[model samples]
Target: MSGGDEQDGPKHEEEGKREQVTVVVLGDLGHSPRMNYHALSLSREGYEVNLVGYTGSKPQIEVLNDEHITLRYMRPPPNLSSLPRLIAFFVKVLWQAFFLFFTLLTGPCNKALLLQNPPGVPAMPVCWLYCFLTRTRFLVDWHNYGYSILALSLRKSHPLVYIYRMIERTFGRLAHGGLCVTKAMKIDLQQNWGITKVTVLYDRPAERFHPLTLEEKHNFLLKLSSQYPCFSSDSPDKTAFTERYADGRLALCEDRPALLVSSTSWTEDEDFSILFHALQDYENVRHQFPDHYPPLIVVVTGKGPLKVHYTSLVADRQWSHVVLLTPWMTAEDYPKLLASADLGVCLHFSSSGLDLPMKVVDMFGSGLPVAAIYYPALPELVKHNENGLIFKTKEELANLLQDWFRGFPQETEIKETYYDFYKNIDEFRKLQWHSCWTCNALPLFSYGKQKHAKE
Candidate 1:
């Protein structure tokens, strides 16, 4: 063999070997699906991944099964809610910075540190420092601007908000590379945050999310019926989605209650009061025109700060035909629950006005059309009269809800509209999360690792 060929063979082979990348998130590991997808993609691309985060919810099957991925749980900071708001925040951040830095300080992540933003206080600063000291590549995934979210609670001119923005711009410029969820974020990152290496990696559904078959739907609904009796048919022996004939045949029920599911984070950006008022309006229509609107089962999922507040607010209202259910589900059941529903509602009003909601992406993957509250970047995911409907006010949202269920499993223009969305969403389901990450995210990690090895 020639001298150069012989010299490079071992180097190339070693470079392709399973190197390690550490992924950090300041939020719950199970809640941050994007970062988990990053770890999974990194594992498939011949990298050993250490997924470091706080513990709470259960992660999905693929992540739990991947041998190359290791989860490192951080000791959560003690709840200091008794302290003043500002004091509590700073104390929590200090504790996180100390713990997170030590976790990475002794980790096997010699190649790169990939982390999410918007709990930007401790994670961004800590991960950046870890990469800087080790000469490892630093990659930030921009889900949204931390400062813009901060502005939601505090005014834009607040000193803390100003300081946080400066910190982001500083480390943002120091990073070796980065990825963001939206093109608008890409442009803004380059313009304001000094992150020249920003790549727009739009959110896609994971592999497990898809339109469930009738059998799958029937099974899932039956499983769900154990807790929520409404999922059972009037017979009490069959699920709401299925019917059994005396002739020994089983089929999908013709007049099933319409199922709608929404994922809410209960943040300032998601105005749930609108959802509440709209549900009341739908209840009125259902009560007044019982023959037309049929019974409705609306399920809301996810954990958040304002969940208790809204739950109690909606509890006092008694509705004869409409029901609101708030249930906590495991990771495995979440995808199935999305697919089992006839429609999905999204209430995220992006804090930055430049990011799309990941929940909507999940809904599309499940082949359920969405009726999302309007925001600037929402059109990127939800198209009016196309795959989904978008609304700005309570009246419009209520109208959409009533119209979508005006006919009880019968011939109506609204049913045809839903049919068109189903067709369009089937086409939308063609792309999955791993495919997008392979094309957009893998190279950045691999190139940095190889370059580091070569040097």
Candidate 2:
């Protein structure tokens, strides 16, 4: 998952020649595609990439070891098992801060690249002060602008919301450059914090993910169909791939109503329970719309602990309309899985705007329409009925699904505007150099984006 072209590496060094540049990246790593991709790419580009992150239960040493990247993991203390979540958060902040200080004191100490994480609210003051004192170049990679998500999560007047806003503003003011996940996010920054000259680098799909060959597609489908017999019409696995789609394939049936769910992290928050229940309601009234029955299928992918938070819902209700898959399949399988789906679902209860999620790009990349529940920064990529749909309620969502099923949803054709923004990652790599800033003679890229600020 991590090798790059050997020629991409830094130039050969003569004896006693000091390292050209040292770039330290602190980013969220637990199930993070951005951090992993950025770290690997930066290292390949000849920078001494030092990445500090958390890799969940199974560490990702292979990536670091292969790319010649230095990794500092924030493994939780064994004794803190009882209070792992809170304790881990504290430890991670301390660890990152410690290293930030360490690098500043001993290493080349020229530029610092930071990915937003918790304690950002607290870390901003210290970071601003650190750069002010040391004169080190401070570049804030506003991967997901922290305040925007917090503001959405906590209504405006809440005390914590106010505190988060303060921190976000301060960080924006202090940062030499800002990076946002989407165009909308950049616009938000300009209007809110007055931070211009921002760069937009999307969460591009990894190099490992590419178009599948015809033979590869056949083998992929055969294995997937065999593994989940439900996908096979001849075999009675009770998963009802037909209900997921009448013809049972993305390309087979045109205008067939379908639902696609892309989950990167296994969490109960996406509210598939509500979605399932709503689908059941549709099933109950199938007789009314015999000619207009829209098939509903839910496809899920990603590796992690096997979990169905809505176990009770699945056992009691008929998920015969649902198709469930695991994290094992190759990324190539995703486009095919989604190609058949007419509507893609990206719903989350968490207010973390820091990530717009890679699945969003996959949905667009597959050319399938999307239905999102107003996840921050997502609107930047998905602009209501232009590319896909965005809804905020059970009734609104159900109605939207029903309408899409009935083939009367707003847009005549799904727009691929955002997809153009991510067509080739080479563009981003090029932009990185274009946006690079000189700090103590080191060329550092400040990935910043701009947008009209929203209060």
Candidate 3:
């Protein structure tokens, strides 16, 4: 049966057939949508899942216990600054690794999935050592092109890049299987690092992201528009809703075009500046084609010290075009909010390699057209001029927006292609996407062996 129907069957029989396996999830569970989905999916399958993550407003036990899984949260250190935070992260990882060692020694763990974080490579050698000694299979969840991410983000090359590459190589060599999020990453592992056991597991739309009812979609858009400053609120007497900026800089309006919105966590390495700069160049799209220009709003969502600083950049540029939703948002509300958007944007600088970003899947689930940088993995999803537009430079954006402003003369055809792509996703090659945890990593039950079963 297809994955579309995969979740329906074997629900009642799942508990009876549940496997006794312990999976220690090590990462920022609060921020990790993929981790949450995988853990929840495993629990639904009645697996004995255990998670080790950070303490946050979101209850650790709340999410897992709801799914009949056990959870343990590591208390964060006192320091809140970046440097202190890094040090704290290292300490926490070490503590978790040691805890995992004990857990493996005392209890039973079938697999250990390590969601890697930068600067935590040092602990990997030790983790691998434990995995080797204990006979517990290890899965290194490779999120991106490590060398490329390092090359783009770090100010100085130093030995850190080489060190990271070395650790990754070692981990790739030692790992029972390397869980990559995209085909490009799998290829990178095999060709660059010479590791064979690589699997492509991408961010598939969770059950939560299924198509919403028309009323639900409409209601969600209502709330989003009402709360947003750009959308009108004070004048309830107004006959029709109008879109205008607070500065009155944006007066031109057209058919309430499908909204293009995006939200993401701010990482020091991510080049959102490139996106913001491109938006500035695309201003003419909003001016000339008031009918087709999306909300001309870019929403920055997620918590970070740089939020205020980044918003200031938007405000300083008089980019009334952007909004900052930096505070916490409910998971239930996230998909609806995203779905309300007409388009989605995921752009990174040239230094960023071809690893699939989580936002791409989020946008796909939202069913919005995408506009992104011409990176490797994204092109797999975004067939230029078909589902989305890829800009090599800000100048290219101006040209694209100009065409878009012309009522997206090709909007209907383009949107249909995008819809078909998302609907018939499985028909495509399985090169870019991987099967969550089970497919990529070899189970601890089968060490020193290799086999495959149809999913």
Better of 1 and 2 by TM-score: 1
The residue pairs in collision within model 1 are: none
TM-score of 2: 0.67
TM-score per candidate, chains pooled: 0.92, 0.67, 0.75
Global CA lDDT computed for model 1: 0.83
Candidate 2: segments with Cα more than 4 A from true spot: 1-3, 7-30, 57-68, 77-111, 117-135, 145-164, 194-197, 208-214, 233-259, 264-274, 285-295, 301-309, 319-342, 349-357, 375-379, 403-455
Q: What Cα-based lDDT does every candidate model obtain?
A: 0.83, 0.53, 0.56
lDDT head-to-head 2 vs 3, winner: 3
- Give the lowest summed-lDDT range of ten residues in model 1: 1-10
Local error of candidate 2 at 209, Å?
4.4
Query: What is the per-residue lDDT of model 2 for residues 1-455, given as tens digits with 9 covering 90 to 100?
Result: 36645764454223332232233334445455555655555555445555655445332444545545666554432344566654664665565666555544554443455545343654566566666776755666666545545566456687766777777777777777656566766777788778885666666544333344434444454556667654455533222233223454332224333555555445444556556555666665443674565455556565433245554455566545444444444544556766545566776554555356567666555555567777656665667755667777766776766666553122323534434423432233233321232221123342211122221
Q: Model 3, range 338-394, lDDT digits (tens) per residue?
A: 665556667543343656666766666666556776766777666786656787776
Candidate 3 Cα outliers beyond 4 Å, as residue runs: 1-18, 57-66, 77-123, 145-156, 233-254, 284-295, 317-328, 349-352, 408-455
Report residue 214 deviation for candidate 1 (angstroms): 1.1
| Among all candidates shown, the one with the greatest lDDT | 1
Worst 10 residues of 2 by lDDT: 446-455
